[model samples]
Target chain A: MSADRLIEAYLNELATAAEALPAERLTELIADMTTHIAEARADGATSEDDVRAVLQRLGDPRDIVEAATDGLVQVDVPPRFRLRDFGAVALLLIGPFALVIGWLAGVWLLWTSDRWTRGEKLLATLGWPIGYGVAVVCDWTSIPLGLTLAIAAAITVAPLIPLLKNGQPGRSATRTRLAGATPATSSNR
Target chain B: MVAEKVFTQLRRGTLEYCVLALLQGEERYGFDLVKELGEIDGMVTTEGTIYPLLARLRREGLVETSWRESESGPPRRYYRSTASGGQALADFTADWERFRTSVDAILRRGNEGRRK
Candidate 1:
């Protein structure tokens, strides 16, 4: 029932439910669970046991994780709305690639350049969707209204690709970066 | 109780093999797999944990899924391992046996040393 015990139970539940999740992601979920327990207990609960009790009442750990991660990553593109889904796919296509290109350019400029190159520093930041934008514009003019939305959807999804691509494990660079974002869970070691 | 010990035993190896083996027979709903693994003597994972692994496996083309209508409620995503998964599982199983015996021999040697 105590806060510590609540966290412990929540972590155990999350770890079990999220067994498929990577070590870093599991750690992140645990950290988030800690935050949830803290917030739930913040209403003047004196001890950790009260927090644990609150977690018990909140239902299964699977339920919590199921909800938290449910729609967060999903685009929820309706199948019936073929146009919209296409737009979403188009959006996804160009967004993150543009973001990564821009980010890499920024990093290189910051490290290599002796002085300000207006284009490298400024124009590169605009790279987040130059690819998707061009596609969207083409769709807008040529495609029907329904199809236009498909292009838009793709653009919208672009930003997530870089973050997701970065999170991929088995990549040496990814593992090194994951070391930073990872929380204090048993999986890290 | 089973889940915790299974997790500790996972170490860095054996996980992939177990997963492939589990899905080798038939497609299973995600939560069902998690629950099944939990009941098993050597797994300590939750649905939350399994989902991410499922995603990665799908990305890697090791498994595939389809949304099937359920009798009781909403459609459920069912996962089944691919042919590649079978080969991978076989390779992993063989490698694990080799490693396990090697480690067991080393430990036994240490115990023998202590007796001496």
Candidate 2:
């Protein structure tokens, strides 16, 4: 293949391998690699063999991507079966029956976790108790037992639906403040 | 493989300071830094690794970058060491001298032992 095509293919592989990287940072990395290749060509790397040699000297794309991510604080989201998730679910489920202590424990998990947003946490904190209250009222008013149970189940499951959606966690207030204090133009200095 | 592993470990430990030392002379773009480092035997094997290292250094306030228009191609981002980077390099240089001396002494002793 031609030099340009070879470079393109290599960059494509790198981009695919580094899909986890932030888009802006990835773009900057690709630009740097492109500049390096262009300079190499300018400095007597003309033939296909020369291009191959240049790419080889850059090492494997996987290794480059690994190095890029090495310093990051990786947040590996636990799977549904993990103790944390199970505990979160269990706490929310049994919160109403255990009174204030159980409910506060569930709320604490929601608020402290980086996984859920403030809005989601607030909804969860309020939703379970209110749902349980309604269910209790229905039970007292001679409502059908199955209907009361269904209402309780829906309320318990509602807050967890947000957890299933795939996306990055919303930044916490402290993180936002810290980012703001760092000058963005420092990179240009 | 063992030699390569040891070289890589050593490079990982010292390459960042080398970059700082280079920048102490003059501001250089990514390609310039890579080319200079690559000229030294076993200093840099993979040319691409320098870019990520530069990026990390920039993020850590050890280096700063500015874009300048090149006469030939598009604009190039030149990197220079920051004050913090200079301080770090100074500290590392002192530490490196002590460490190298200690290692050399041990190696010389071993050589004398083998000669006897």
Candidate 3:
């Protein structure tokens, strides 16, 4: 069989086998199988009859899924779920503190800009320090679990600081699919 | 952006039950479940994806598997829903209906608001 024909048979067997298989995953599996079959054919499995027989020996498609997902646990959290939940909880819990800090930060920058405008470069440049002081004082006062909350906020915001370091969002899903197919020891050993 | 997450969670919550439901009456192996899901208009998913889920259900003791030799090929694993799995599926169906109805209501409400 041609590589394409071999892949078609392979996928047909697969589709007929699993009633809940996702199409994306099936397409991925078919692409992999097709590539492998092409390579095998190139390696001198000359006849369609021979190739068909070889494919048959590779076990049923349904068995492949059963082996792959058996006992596997995956957490498919959407990108903005916990982040949104995080927003909601933070709003109820520490939203007031955040707003104050942001406002004070902007005010502090303004004062620093004023000092620069007045040519008081030596000592008046401490506007940032002043802002930090104000924010810390606010943190110490009303935010109940203020320090712990601030620490968590810093950590959470720190990830966003390096968002660009991660792969771009558009193709990330496809990349995830590919990475997940790190062939399990259950098969092709 | 918020909507994307809601849709994803909705799909995730129901997909597990859908898989179990398909296998309720008969003991089918992996690919059969994938094909069945794909045949549905908006329910298409891949077999490769379903395998991991099957493994999950088996591990959770919601489903069980055994080998059944196929005449066309080698022996295949056959999966059947367990009693607990069946019960869970029933609960899931209830939950799904509630979620669907509520979501539909919300969508309709939003549409009416837009029209107004």
Candidate 4:
């Protein structure tokens, strides 16, 4: 292939390898490589061999991408339909016969996950128990057992509605923090 | 291979400072810095890696960049050492000198002991 075609192919590979980079950063990286290639050509790298030598000095695209991404910590958002989430939901929804075990497992899932804040987790964990407690109290107060139980179940499940619908809780916090920091940084510029 | 790995580790820790040192005298564009660092043995294995490093340095406020029209061809982004970069380089240079002298002394003593 011609030297220009070879450089284009190398850049295409670099773009694919650096797909995870932020768009602006990826553009800058590509622009830098293009400038570097151009400068090399100006410095007498006319032949395909000379172009290859220049690219070889740049090393592998994968290695370059890895180096760029090194030390960056990304927040992991869990998928909507994880088995753990389903299991926790199932345990919470089950009748009070297995309520103790189900509540413990649900609480465990809530605490272990990075998806929810501690406050959200506490609300969800207390939801069913509080509902169940209210149901028992109503039952002792001469209220119809069936109606009280239904009301209790509804109350217990209320806090979990947001958790279920959102699938992830702390995303808002992350987004807001990032949004808040952006303006401050831009204002300094 | 082991020696090369060790050298790579050492270069990784020191390459940013070297870039800052290069920019101390004159502002250089990306390609210019890449070419200079690339020529140094064990300094930079990959020319592309320097671009990312430069981006990081820019983000960290160690280097400032400005776009200027080149004498020939398209505009180039020239990088110069910022005040913070200069101070960091000065501190690193002092630490490097002390560390190098200590290491050199130990190696010399080891050589003398072997000769005796």
Number of the top-ranking candidate, with DockQ as the measure: 2
- For B2-102, candidate 1 gives per-residue lDDT tens digits of 57655555632455457778999789876566556656764543334455556556655778988887664445678899987777777777777898899
lDDT of 1 at B81: 96
Question: Which residue pairs show backbone clashes in model 4?
Answer: none
Q: Report the lDDT tens digits of candidate 3 across residue range A1-189.
A: 274577687778866564344565555455544533544455466687767754664457766655444333344423332233223323323333567565344334433332123332222223334435656666767756667456555543443322223312222222221114333232101
Q: Quote the lDDT for A134 in model 2.
A: 81
RMSD of 4: 9.8
lDDT of 4 by residue, A116-138 (tens): 66776788888887897898789
The C-alpha lDDT values of all candidates are: 0.54, 0.77, 0.54, 0.79
CAPRI class of candidate 4: acceptable
Of the pair 1 and 3, which is ahead by TM-score? Answer: 3
Candidate 4's C-alpha lDDT? 0.79
lDDT tens digits by residue: candidate 1, A1-189: 345655676678767776544465567566544543444444454576665455554457776455334323423222232233233323334435567554454444332432323443333334345545856687757668666656655544454344233322222222111123222122111
- Poorly placed runs, candidate 4 (over 4 Å): A77-189
lDDT of the structure predicted as candidate 1: 0.54
Model 3: lDDT equals: 0.54
Q: What are the per-model DockQ values? A: 0.03, 0.34, 0.05, 0.23
User: What lDDT does candidate 2 reach at residue A8?
Assistant: 89
